[model samples]
Target: MSAVLASVAGAALNIGTNPLAIAGLVPIVAAGLTFLRYLRFDPEDHPVSVQKLLPEYDFVIIGGGSAGAVVASRLSEIANWTVLLLEAGPDENEVTDVPSLLGYLQLSNMDWMYQTSPPTDSQYCLAMIGDRCNWPRGKVLGGSSVLNAMVYARGNKRDYDAWEAQGNPGWSYKDILPYFRKSEDNRNPYLARTDYHNSGGYLTVQEVPWRTPLAVAFLQAGKELGYDVRDCNGEKQTGFMITQTTMRRGHRCSTAKAFLRPVRHRENLHIALNSQATKIIIDRRTKRALGVKFVRSGRNKVVRAKREVILSAGAIGSPQLLMLSGIGPKEHLESLNIPVISDLKVGYNLQDHVGLGGFTFIIDDPITFTRNRYQSINVVMEYLLREKGPMTSQGVEGLAFVNTKYAPKDGLWPDVQFHFAASSINSDSDQIRKITGMRDSVYNTVYKPLGDAETWSLLPLLLRPKSTGRISLKSSNPFVYPDINPNYFTHKEDILTLIEGIRIGLNVSDTPSFKRFNSRPHKMPFPSCEQYEFDTDEYWECSIRHFTFTIYHPTSTCKMGPENDGDAVVNPRLKIYGLENLRVIDASIMPNIVSGNTNAPVIMIGEKGADLIKEDWLGQHFRKT
Candidate 1:
C-alpha cells in the first residue's frame, strides 16, 4: 500500500514537478483508484448548489486573494447569497503549506513570476543610471500574501494622514485606526498593552521565534544605537524594534489561513481556482456591471453577478483586470482596439517601495545557522514532530527604525524601515530560482545572487520614497505581462533616503551593546558594499542607482482619488469610477505604498473591506447595489 501510494503521488499532473521523475506516482495512482476529491478551502459544509444561477452569481470576485477571500467569506455569511471567486492558479500544494519556505517565492509554480518589458528611451533610462526593473505577483490562491516574505510591519500614522491630505476622506490615521484594530489578532503581551491592536481578530500577528545568533545580534546592535527599542506596530511605528510577522505559532498566517479557510464552508460561498477572468460584463443599456467572463481548465464561462464584482487581485492584477475590461485611459485602450467603456486612468499612478541594499557579515561562532547537516536534519525532525525550534524561524526577525531626516523628528513614523534576516542569503532566494528554472524559462531567471559568502543582510527598504511607477496594457491579452515601469528613484530625493537607511544600518552595527555580542559584521570585506570603490558621495550615488531592487511591494496601479480627479481610476469607496456594481479592494487602492512589507497591510485591507462591504449593504438594507 505504501509503494502504491508513492506511485500515485508521482503520477499527478503537477504544474512544475517532473513528469518523468515519476519516482512514486503510485500514491496519486492509488488516490485515483479510490476516486478522491480535490482538497478544498471548504470541505465540511453542505454542498453549495451551482444550478439555480449558473450564468450569474451574487458576487463574482476576481482573484482569490487577501481581500477577495475575506470579501467572499463575509458576503456569503448573510445566507443564500451566492459568491464566485476566480483564481489564475491551483489551490492545493505542499509548497504553499510549508511555512519556512514562504520567502522562497520565485519557486516552481507558486508565483506569476513577471518582469517589466525593459524600459525604452522616451521614458528615461534606468540603464543610464543602472537598474533592472522586475516584478512578482502570486498567481495562486492567496495572491502575493501567499508568496511574500512573512514580515508583518504596518506603515506608521504619517502615511495615512498624508493620504487624507491628498483628499482621500476618512483615510487619516486617526480616522482609520479602528480598521487596523479590527483585523489584527495580536498575541504578544507587549503589543496587547497598546490601544492600537485589537485582541479578537482573525489574523494571528506575532513575532517570529529567534533561533539563530544573527537575531540576537541585530537587536543588541539596535539598542546600542540609541533608537528606543519598541514595537514598530504599537503606539508608534517610530522606534527601533524586533519586527513582528504574520506567523501563527511559528507557521505562516496568510489571509487564507485566517479569515478565508474557516469561513469558506458558508453555504453561499464558491471559490473557483485555476480560473482567469478576461472581462467584466457591463450591461451598456442598464449601466450596471452584470458579471465577469473567465476561463477554467480550458473551458470558458460567464458568471453573472447579482450583487457586485470585487477585484482583490493586488496592484498589477486589479488594474490589469480593469483595463482589460475597458475601464482605463481612452487613448491607450483605443490604440489596443479595446472599445472604451470608461476612461478613468485605471493603470496609472503606480507606486512601489524599492530597496537599495548594503551588506556586511559572516559567522564566527561554532554556532552558525548552517552548522552540520545532521543538526539541520535534527531541527527539521523536531519541527515536523512538534512544530517548534530553529525550523520555525521566519528568516528576518529583527528591524530597526531610524531617524534619517536631518531635521528634528516629527513625532511621526521613522523615515526608514530596516530588516534583519537570521541566516545570510546574499541574493533574493537562490533556492527558488533553481526550481523555477526547471519548469519555466521566463519565470526562472528572475534572480541574480547578490550575497557575500557566509553573510546575512540588514536590508533597508525605502518605505516612503517619492518615486512612482505606471502600469499600461500590453496588446490587450490577459495572458501577456503588462508594461510595468516602476520608475525607481525617479525623484532624486529617493536616492538620499536609501543612503540614510544604509547609514542607519552602519550606525547600529557600531554600537557598544552590540559590541558585547560581537554583532558587528565580519571584517573581511573591509570598506564593504561592492569593491568598485564607491568611496566618494558621487560614487555612492552611482552605486545606489545601479544596485537597487524591488522589495516586492507594488501598489497604487488603480489609485483612489476624489471622484473628479483626472488621473484617478477608483473612488475612495474602492469602486471603479463610472462603473456600477464593480469594486476593487486590494493593495492597488493604496494612494501611496506603506512603510513596510505589504502582506499584513494587504490582509488589513481585506478585514476592513469586509466591514465596509457589510456597512454599505446594511445601509442600503441588503438591497442590490
Candidate 2:
C-alpha cells in the first residue's frame, strides 16, 4: 500500500501540481529518511581537528574560503611546507549541499549577513529594512562559494586583456587562460571537448541536472531576438545558454569540497575552524607581515608564519582586516588611534554587479517552479534516490549576455547580463523577499498580491557598473563589520545603463517563444511610483531605485596596479606595496570586477595566485599548469 501511494504521489508531482501529493508521500519519505540515517552516509569528510597549534608554520592563510581553500590545498602539495588555514565558521554540512536551499542559507549562520550602509542622498535600497541592502558573504569553510548561487560564469576575455592594458603584466586573457583551465573539470561532454574547457580538475563545472520549462523558453526567446544559443563562457561574450554551475552529481561542490576535502589527510595542512583572525601582525619597524593574531574558543592566540601570510578574507573582510591592522589611509587610521603601517588605499574602488529586481512575467502554464509544489515529499524522494529533481535546480536556470546601447560599439563585449529564474520573487512565498531585506510594506504592495501564480523573471544585471563605492573601518575593533557604501547609481551612467537593460528584458519577454505560454508583464505599479504611467521609462526608473538588487559580486577594494597608480594597494605581483611577506589572493585584488558572476573568476584568481607564489619563491620553473 505504501509503495502504491508513493508511486501515485510521484506521478502527481511530475504534473507540477496535486494538493494531495504531499500528504500521501509524507510517510514514505519519513521512513526512507529513517532508513538512510541508519546507513551513516556522510558526504563531507571531517578534517582532523588541531588540539594544539604549532608556534609557527611555513605559511598561514587567512579566511578558508574559495581562494583560501585552493591556496592551502595547492601549497600543501609541497611536502615540507607547513600550512595553516583559519576559518571563522564551521564546516559545510549535508543541508548546505542541496542546491535549491541557497536562498535559505543567506541570512542563516553560514552567511556573514553584512548589510550595506544607507546612502546619504541616494534612493537605492529604499524599500529594504532600514533602507540597507543585505550583503551575504559566506562565513563557512568554503566562504562565499558555499553560499553563492553556484553559477560558474567566467567573464569576457577582454575583461582580463583590459587589466593587462592598465600597466599590470601577465594578467591578459591568454596568460590567465591556463589557470582557469587548470582548476576546472568540465563535466559536460560537449563543453569538455572544446579547446576552451578542460576535463580533469578540482572544480566540477556542469549544467544543473534539472530545470523548469521556463528555462527552455528563455533560451528560445533569446534566439527569437536574433541572439545565438551558444556557450557564453566560450569563444564569444554575447549569447544565451543554460547556466553552468559548480555542482557535482546534483550537489553543491564548493571549494571546500573540491580542494580541501580531498587533501584533508595531508599532514602538512592544518585547518583551525571557528577561529577569527583579529589582525595581521606586521613588524612595526620593518613593515613585514610576520604572523596572524586570532581568537579561538574564547582564547586569544598568535601564530607566526615563516614565509608569508596570505589574506583571502574576501572583498569586505580583507579591507576591514587591513584597515584594522593600520594598513589604510593615514588620516583614517590616526582618527582611530591606530598606528599606521602602510598608508596606501586599502578599501577604495569597490565595485559590484547591480540589477533591477521585481521584473516578473506572469505565465498561464504550470511549468514554472513554486515552493509549495516543488518542495513536496515526492520531490525529496526523487532527489535522494536518483539525484534529479527541482532540488537540483539552482533557481537561476538560464543566462543571456546582451550589449546595451551604452556599451562599446565594438560589439564583442556585453554591458548587461540577464539571469532567468524559473521562480520569481513571489513564487517562493516571501522567502526570497524576507532574505533580501525587503520591507513588509513593499512586499505586500508589489509582490504579495501575486500569491502562488506561476511566474518567471529576468533580472537585468548591470555587468560593468561605472559607479564605485568604498569599504571603510567602522572602528578599531576587528569584530565590527566594515561600513560598505556601494554608492549604487551615484554615477548617472549607471542608472541609464540599468534602464536600458530593463528595456531589453521587456523585449525578450515579448518574443514569440515567450508568447507560447501567454507570458505577459505583471503591470502593477509600485505605490511609490504611482504618479507615472506604468511601463514608461520614468516608471521603470522609479521602480529600479525602489527595488535595486545586488548579484553579490563585490570586488576591487584592494586593487592591483603598477607603482605609479595611487589607487593601487598591491602591485602586479599581488604583493602589498611597501610591505613584505604579505599578499591578498581573493576577489578583493581585482582592479575591476568581471563582466558576469564572480565565483568562477575568483577561483581562477586562486589558481593563478598559487602559481604566482610558486614562481616567486620556488622559481618560474616550479610553476604548475
Candidate 3:
C-alpha cells in the first residue's frame, strides 16, 4: 500500500477494521483524493483558459455557491452548451469537510464575514459585536453549505403554497416537491420509503451515527409533552426528531461536493476561483444582461454570455451585484451615481430566523460533544475509519418544530423551531469570544461561570417575523460590505411570540424524561432583566433581546412576485423584471423565507430553477428546428 494509504489503514486497524470496515474505506479514500486533486490542480496553475478562452459562453453563472454550483452543473449537461462559474474564494479544503468544525469556519478565510449594522432602534443583539450580529456567509465554492451546520430541513408545504398564492404560479407545495425529491438521496431507511423523500440522487440526507444521550432525552421529552415522533420533514413537520444532515460517509455533502465535484470532468463546464464578479454587464439601452465583469489577480476581465447570465450570489451578494449593475431602487442607485436600468426594489424585504441564544439547561451527566472524553485520539480514529463518533455529528442534533399558542388557530404550519444542542456549558459564550468577535468582559460576566457545567441548550428560532429589514450600499464600491439590518423585534408581536416559545420550551424541559437527568434551566441572570422576577415573562423578554442572534437563514432581498406586485424584482419565472436573459436563482428570490433552515430549501430552488431554464431553452430550440 502507499504510505498515505498505510497511515489511513493504521487508524482503521486500531479500531479493528473488519471486512465491512475495510470496504467502506475505499470510497472515503477516493473522495479524499478527488477533493485534494481539485484543490491542487486549480485552473490558475494552467493556461488562463478559465478566463481568456471562455470570454464568450452560451451561459455564465456567477458564484460557484450552493445554488450556483447546481445550476452550472445541470446546465452543462446539455453537452453542446458551454458554462462558466465564477467564485470569489478558494476551493473547499479538508477542514470544511468535518461537520464538527462548522462553527469555526464562520469568520474564517472561507467566510464572507459580514456583520449586520449595529441595531439603530432595537437592543436585540446588545451583547454581540459592537451591538451588531456576525453574519457569516460562505465565500468558498459551495458557499454557506460549507459553513452552515448541515441540518437538512425542507420547510413546511404551506410556505411554498403561500408563495404560489402570492402570484408565483409554479411554486406551490406540490409543484416544488418533485424538485426536492430530485436533489435528495435519502440514506435513512426510515425515511426512504416515505412519499416525501427519494433515493439515488445527488444530495445525501442521513442520520449522523454519533448522537448525544441528552439529545435522545430531548426527543423523549417531546414525547412526554404529547408531541408525536414524526419525520419532521416528511408528512408532518410539527414534532421532535433527530436532525437529518447533509453528510455522506461521515463527510459534509456540500453542493460543491455532492453536485459540482462529481461533474467537474465535463469539458463544457468551466470554473474560475478567486474571481470576484465586480459588476453585471448590462446593456443600458436595452436593459439586457449580456455578461459579467470580474476581477481576478488584480486584473479586470469581461466574459459575455450568448444565452443568459444567472445570479446565484445568494441573498447579500445577488442584490449587491444587481444594485452595482444599476438594476435596483432608482433613488438608492442614483445616490451612488449608479444610473438606473430597471427601478426595482432589489434589496428590500430581508427576513431571517432570529434565534434566542441565551436559553440553556444544565444536565447532571457529562454527555456532550465538548466533553474532554469525546475529544480524544480514539474518537478521531473512529471517525477517520468508520465515519462514526462525535466528529460526524452536526452539533445541534435534536430538533423540534412547534406552533406557539400565539400562532394562528387555523394555520397548520409551525411558527417556531427549537434546536437542542448538547453543550459542555457556556459553549456559546466561548464560541462567541473565540469566533464571533465578542469582548472578554462580556464573556466573563455573561458566560464564564457555566464553563464546566454539563449543559444542553435549546434555541427557539422565530420562523416567520412580521418585521422586515434590508441590504443597502455602504459605498458605490462592490467590495465594500453592504449595510445589513435584520431589524429584529421591531414588531412587538415578534417578541411576544418568542416569549410564548420560551414558556413552551421550559414546559418541555420540566417533563419527567428530562427531569430524570436533573435537567433544569441554566440561570445566567442578565443584569438587564433585574427589574423582573427570574423565569417570568418579563425577564425572558429582556433575555431574548440581549441574546437573540441570527440562525443564519436570510432570504427575500430580491423578492420574487408578478411584475404588478410593486416590491417584486424577479417575476414568477425568476427572471429580473425589465431585464432580458438574466435570472436570480438563490435564497434572495424567495417571496417569503421558508419556515425552517434555508439550506435544504435553497438547494431545491437551484434544482427547480435549472429545470425551468432547461425547459425554456430546449423548447425554444425545438421550436426553431
How well does each candidate superpose onto the true structure, as a TM-score? 0.84, 0.95, 0.92
Off by over 4 Å in 1: 1-53, 120-133, 371-375, 406-408, 426-429, 432-453, 516-535, 620-625
| lDDT tens digits, residue span 1-625, model 2 | 4664466566655745554555344334534543453244445475765768899999999999989999999999889999999999888866677788777778888889899999885679877888899999999999999999899999999999999999899999998888889998999999999989998999999999999887888889888888899999999979899999999878788999899988999999999999999999999999999999999998999999999999999999999999999899999889989899899999999999998888898988888887667777667768766778988888899999998898989778999999999786765655677778888888888888887888899899999888899999889988888899998988878888888889889888898888988888998877898899977778888888888899799999999999999999998889999999999999999999999999999998898888888888898788476
Model 2 weakest 10-residue run by lDDT: 30-39
- Per lDDT, the best of the predicted structures is 2
Which tens-of-lDDT digit does each residue in 510-557 have in candidate 1? 666444445555322212233544334554455455445566788888
- Model 2 Cα displacement at 31 (Å)? 14
User: Mind giving the per-residue lDDT tens digits that candidate 3 earns over 330-371?
Assistant: 999999899888899988999999867858787787676663
- Error in Å for residue 33 of model 2: 5.5
| Candidate 3 lDDT (Cα, 0 to 1) | 0.82
Displacement of residue 605 (Cα, Å) in model 1 is: 2.0
Q: List the candidates ranked by TM-score, beginning with the highest.
A: 2, 3, 1
Ordered list by lDDT, greatest first = 2, 3, 1
For candidate 3, the per-residue lDDT at 214 reads: 80
